[model samples]
Target: MAVVKISERGSFRKEYIRWWKHPEKDIQLFDWLDENERERKTLFSPGYLRDRRNPLPYGLTKMECGLRAAAALFAGDPQRGQDYAANPRRFSMSVHDHIRSLRFKYRRFNSKIGAKVSNMAYVDIQGPLLQKIDQLMLVECPEWIRLHFHWRTDPYYNQYWPKDQPTAREKPVQANAPERQLRKSSPGLVNQKRALQASAVRVRDGQNKANSPVMELPTPRENSNSGTTQVRSSSTTQEIETLASEGGHASVIHGGATNLDGSITSIQRLELLIQLRKLDIEREDKKYAAELQRAQVEAANRHQSEKHEIMKQLADYVTGGKGSTGGSSTGRDE
Candidate 1:
């Protein structure tokens, strides 16, 4: 394993205190601090780290760390960051640790200049970081900074601000919400909802009406307003609506009696169908009767013709007509 090149400020401070306590004038302090102990500090950790890939160590270089951070921020989603961190093939946790360690190192390094170890030098790393942030296209920089963060006032941010959006604007008032509330609270809408609920209830009750015994309802007397009906069922509502829409107050209650009338209509239709079938049957029977009478007449005529033919043959034999044996004998005597 590569030996760690960095350490926490406390350890560096301890080493600095040790070096201070010792007196070997020939031993160089540069060699003591650098070759012996390299100095660094950052916001994320006051602890030490080993050989890493940050440019300022900061990353494989500033570019790689910036790329990773940019992708995390630009996607604006937690899952995107998770996916990047979870992938080992393309990522190095050591590299992430390096950037994390050096991200705000400049401020700490500046603090260290007048303190115990003045050897830990400052490096301006935020410029490259800001460049990466711009490349990632975040509208604004992240806001959480307890240390020195001068990048927000940088020239690039100032130039980019007015070029894309010139001025800060007032929050626009929402005008449509009150209208929506008014529509929802409208009297007509409430009545329509109630009517629909009633229709649904009627339909559900109608489904099992056969099992429920029907109670006797008062007979509905015919009124001049009989074109309309009060809502006994969904069908009755439709009838009332039709009458009311036509500019009439005509109202009536369709009772159970209407059901009998409907059945009677159906029975009448069946009777008509039966009468049509009977007419066809009677016509067929008459045709058969005509054919039978014609056949009987033809048989009678055929029998009479055969009887006449037999009688003529007997008469011819008795009278001794020509070609008979008596007729030939008489001719010979003549």
Candidate 2:
């Protein structure tokens, strides 16, 4: 530690003694007094601090005492400032204490001088002071001096310390191991075997219905007995057959018909022949009607033309007879 003998006549110690007597004389003095009162209240209060030991030395103001106490805590000895540089914490704390004591005392003496010293003090002590205090408490501290004093015994220190309690990786039991195994299996294997068997039975029943002889009927024959060829009564197959026969007759009337699937049924093929014959008869009837109308119109026009020709011939014949008789009478008169 470097032995820095701060004399009673030094600027810092002198200003501190002066302000201690008259606290309200300067604004800085008043501020230090209020800060000292608050700090004392905190240290003496029941809920604030567990230990009530005064950390400051005797014969010093609160600010000066606090600086000296910090130096003594980190320094080699409180009586002599020696062997301080050997320990980084001690050296840092001593420097911080000297600077802070000087700053407060200077503020009490001269405001302008205090401001300049404070700026320089921030540059030198701010980073080192925080680092040293944080190491002492084994936690992080704030950068600002006011905050450092405000929360001197940090509650966040124990909270941020690495806890000894176990984490999730340390636990043995897993909550979702069974669910994870279920997800890894195929969906087909996951479903019950009984359900798959029931589905297969239903599909087989459908194929049997499609291939059964009861659903397929024999083709119609021209020479076969019509009674035997007719569908059996009291059967769903019979009803379908009757509907098919009716559809055949509709196709005969309309010339063509189709089933729901757009394919021509057996009934539609039989009806198509009948429809072609009906269409031929209808075409002959239309041709006869048209020919009759044309003949009627031609006969009426020929009759009118003949009547006009007969009237012109009668007028010419009568004029010729009259001219011939007049010429013969003129010859007899001559």
lDDT winner: 2
Give me the overall lDDT of model 2: 0.34
Candidate models: Cα lDDT each: 0.31, 0.34
RMSD of each: 42.5, 51.5
TM-score of candidate 1 to 2 decimals? 0.20
Q: How many residue pairs clash in each candidate at the backbone level? A: 11, 3
Model 2 Cα lDDT, one tens digit per residue, 272-322: 222333334556768988999899999999998898899889988999999
> Which residues of candidate 2, in runs, are more than 4 Å off?
1-261
Candidate 1 C-alpha error for residue 316, in Å: 3.0
- Measured against the true structure, the TM-scores of the candidates, in listed sequence, are 0.20, 0.21
What candidate 1 gets wrong by more than 4 Å, as runs, is: 1-264, 320-328, 331-334
